[model samples]
Target: MDIDNIAAKAAAKIDAVRDARVNAVKTAAASSVELQEAVQLLAAAEQKYAKDYQAALRADWTESDLRGFGLDAPSKKAGGRPKGARTRQSKPANDAASEKELIGTTSENW
Candidate 1:
């Protein structure tokens, strides 16, 4: 009921909230580190699986043989530019005479 008592209560509430926020942030940071490590492990496992699958194919295993074991062949990914995409061609080097012929003025005049 007194001013000092009221101030102390408010300060206690603020401190409690700040402590909760710090704990939450620390928990989330730890979880994020764990998830990043898990993702790297998953990627390495996927790469190994693909390599083994390719080896099986090279060892005279057919798609159907792999499919019988519930494994499907990985889809082929197309590399490079997509269809109908035009690449920019570099301009040819022009001598001073050619430049003058095209623009009616040479670098010397400029």
Candidate 2:
């Protein structure tokens, strides 16, 4: 009920929130790294599969022969944001030019 006790309680709450934010940020960064590794692995596997399929074709593989191995020798869809996914708003095209043209800009401009 005293001022010192109230201040201490508020400080404790703030510290708890700060710790939670730090943990959340760390978790997000770790997840991002894992996602990147997974994407790279997927790309490598796709590339290897394509190379193997091409080698099979060079060895005189027919469509039926490739199908027997459960692979279709055809062009594939490019990797990108999923269909119907909302697009992120990009910065205005002139943002860089405007920034450079700003009067008396310094390192602290941001």
Lowest lDDT block of 10, candidate 2: 74-83
lDDT of each: 0.81, 0.81
lDDT of 2 by residue, 2-110 (tens): 9999999999999999999999999999999999999999887777777677677879988798899888874644344576888798778698677767744665586
- The TM-score between candidate 1 and the true structure equals 0.62
Clashing pairs in 2: none
Give Cα distance to truth, residue 58, candidate 2, Å. 1.3
Clash pairs detected, candidate 1: none
Q: What TM-score, over all chains together, does every model reach?
A: 0.62, 0.62
Superposition TM-score, candidate 2 onto the true structure: 0.62
Model 2 vs truth, CA RMSD: 21.6
* Candidate 1 runs further than 4 Å off: 74-110
